[model samples]
Target: MKVTRYTKADAEQWDAFVRASKNGTFLLQRAYMDYHSDRFADHSLIFHDDKGHPVALLPANERDGVLQSHGGLTYGGIICDESMTTPRMLEVFDVLLEHLRTNGLNRLLYKTIPYIYHLNPAEEDRYALFRADARLYRRDVLSVICQDRRLPFQKRRARKVSQAQKLGLVIEASEDLEAFWAILEANLAAVHGVRPVHSVEEMRLLNSRFPDQIRLHVCKENGGIVAGVVVFNATRVAHVQYISSSERGREIGALDLLFATLIERDYADQAYFDFGISNEQEGKVMNVGLIEQKEGFGARAVTHDYYELSVV
Candidate 1:
């Protein structure tokens, strides 16, 4: 086996491999990862077999002598295709550790992709991590609804949706990012006292690049946007990347209406509806109110774990 650093010249090859990888997402693609290239020192890796055929890839970055699978993405680790086996992954990690140590990196942080995102059964990396004596550093709870056997929404949530319907709120696809950004900015600031991770311009650029994968859905009242969500469609999973509501929207339960329509109509065919994470402070703190709201919609927990491995 052999390992090599990723380069601009390998962009096409990298994207092709990601598309075929069992647990890979579009987020790992070069176009997406490089959106904020000025921010991180990328040190992604590509692994190949003795015959020189590409076998696996790692979307990662290096900072202060520590290599992170990818600090910018929701999850990142070894991405491989169906051909990858437990032994092969172990070998890959062995070579990967050697490469990192040779480059003077003393530690590595790995984020495991949640199972809901997998196109096939691909958990060999977890076993490999255990074999490598990696420590569990963090574990976040993701609220998700299994579309095939979805649970009924709680009575209060159902009532809210009914009330929203009675108010004649319109749920539809939207192109008004500026308007939604205004609502998102205000909502995040008022609730968390922080701004959005992505600015309007950056989101617009990403949406334009991934037209089909990225979408905006809004609940409107009297021709004005009241609430909205940015869904990142990743094959089987419809992930809510951003969700927010205006004051009036909340009063009238616009979010309940929007989510009901999205889950039942827009993305009903998808396998799962992921509401992202509800943990804070590296999973030590649980936001009960935030998670309860998601749970009201019949969502349950799926964990996203982070692991640390010593390179020395």
Candidate 2:
């Protein structure tokens, strides 16, 4: 086995591997990872077997002697294909730890991809982590709706949808990101006291790069945008990356209407609908109201876990 540090020249190979990996997502693609290159000192790695065939890839960055699987991404770990077996993954971790130790890195922070993202049953990395004595550092709850076995919306949410329909709210694909960003900015500041992770320009750039994968859907009334959601479309899931509404939008239940259309019409065929995480303070805090809103839409829980490994 051999491990190689990633370089610009590896972009094409890396992207191809990610597309074929059972647990990989667009976030692992070089294009997406490189967007915030100026902020992180990338230390991504690619693994190869004795026959010189690539088997696994790790998207990571280093800071203060600690390596994070990927700080910019929501979740990232060793990306592998269906061919990766338990024993092979264990070997991969052995090599990974050795490489980290040799490189003067003392710790590793790994974020496991949620099971919903996998194209196949791929949890070999979890066993490998256990073998390496990695500790679970955090766990976040994501509310998701399984398409085939979806639960009916709660009474309050059902009423909201009816109210939105009576108000003549129209849910449709939208290209007006600037207008939505204003609402998102205000909503986050007023509610969470924080700003959107991506600036307007950054999101627009990403949208341009992955137009098909990233989309904006909005609810409008009288030709004016009132509520919107930025969805990141993966192969098996449609994830709500950002959701917000104007004051009038909330009164009329624009978000409820928008989500109903997304889950029941636009992406009805998708396997899962991810409402993203509602946890704060590194998973130690749960925002009850925020999670309740998602649960009311018939979504259930999925946990996203983080692990810490000492490279001594």
Candidate 3:
């Protein structure tokens, strides 16, 4: 087998391969890579068999000599066929590491495909790659939906939801990417004391690139957008990718009403709503609390694995 890098022209084949595989992530697609390639210098790599058919793919981004699974990507890496286990995965990783190292990259990080254990043979193959990369470790990605019977009825959850309704917040679908991003940035800083993962330009790029696949919703009161969410529609689920609100947003229950409205109107057909990840060690009681909140609305909890590797 031979390893080769991919070009923009290779997108269709890349996405086709990911869809054909059990453990494929949307981040591996060309559209995502191109949208965020500015953040990385080396964005694509593929493993091809003797007949030249691609067997494994590693979609990556490089920054300051460090290679990442993907920064703009929610998840990605050495996605391969189900039959290829440890030896095959090790071979591919061996090549990939060499390429990155030769290119002067120092570290590698990856968030493996979500729910790999629950997937089919193709998806299970990701575990093989994980096994080959000795430095990799698992981290928790918390999720909740309205269906989970085990979800607790936290007091804060009730208060927040009720407060949002009392504020008379109105939820509406919108295409105003700039406005949404501004709300996200402000919300993150005020609530979490941090910035969002994506910049306004990047958010706009993603929205413009996959307009149909993404939905932007804003919760308004008195002609102001108090909170907003960016939802991504995959094959079977709707992922709540980004959500943020101002100080007034929290007091007014803008978040609660916004999510409730989303669940009722836009994503009623989908089986689940993924609220994204939260760091478990940061005393993330709020994150856990959020899982419960979504559960009250008929969601359940699911965990995804996070992995890291050193190029040796």
Candidate 4:
């Protein structure tokens, strides 16, 4: 395999390859990855077979002599199509390391795409990372509900959903996201002292770029927004990218109702419904309260991994 650095000219080829990859999602597309190009020093890569057909692509960035498999996104790694096999992946990793070494980057931080996101088995990179002796640096557990085999919500959550239903909280898919972003921003600021990674404008731009892939579902009370979740749709997954509710919304269990509805009816067709991660401190600390809420809705643990490699 021959390796090449990604450039703006390769956008079309990169996105087409990502779309066909077994493990890649729209998030790895150049349109989505480059949205925050100003923040990250893009050093993403492409791997081609001897005939010059792209076999794998890595959505990555470099800074301070290190390369991250994209710091802007939730998770990423080597994106490969059906043509990729274990033996070929071993060579891919070898070429990948040499490419990194030649570029004077000595270390690589790789974030693996969770299995639920994969359209097919695509863990060859995980094996390659092990062969390269990559260090397992971080592991975050996503609370996910396997829709077809989903369990009923806990009694408390069920009661809340019932109560919220009586409150007449109307759920609708919205094209405009600013109203929901305001609620999300306020809730995050008050509860976590942080802001959402994507601004309303940025999110709107992305939604416009991938309208069918990204969606905002909001719960409204008497024509006012109370709660909402931004969902990123993948091959067989419906992942909650951002979730938030107003104080009054929380009081009435608006989120419980929202998720119950989404899991039970709205997104029931999706193979898995992810509630995002409940860990902090680089996946070292588990937020019991946070995860318990997801578990109450029949969500179980699915770990997302991060690994480090010494290329030199």
> How many residue pairs clash in each candidate at the backbone level?
0, 0, 11, 0
lDDT-better candidate, 1 vs 3: 1
What ranges in model 4 sit over 4 Å off?
none
- What is the C-alpha local distance difference test score of candidate 1? 0.94
Native-to-model Cα distance after best TM-score fit, residue 127 in candidate 4, in Å: 0.8
**What residue runs in model 1 are displaced by over 4 Å at the alpha carbon?**
none
Clashing residue pairs found in predicted model 1:
none
RMSD of each: 0.7, 0.7, 3.9, 0.9
For candidate 3, the lDDT comes to 0.69
Candidate 4 on 276-295: residue-level lDDT in tens? Answer: 99999989999999999999
lDDT score for residue 259 of model 1: 97
Model 1: residue 143 alpha-carbon error in angstroms: 0.3
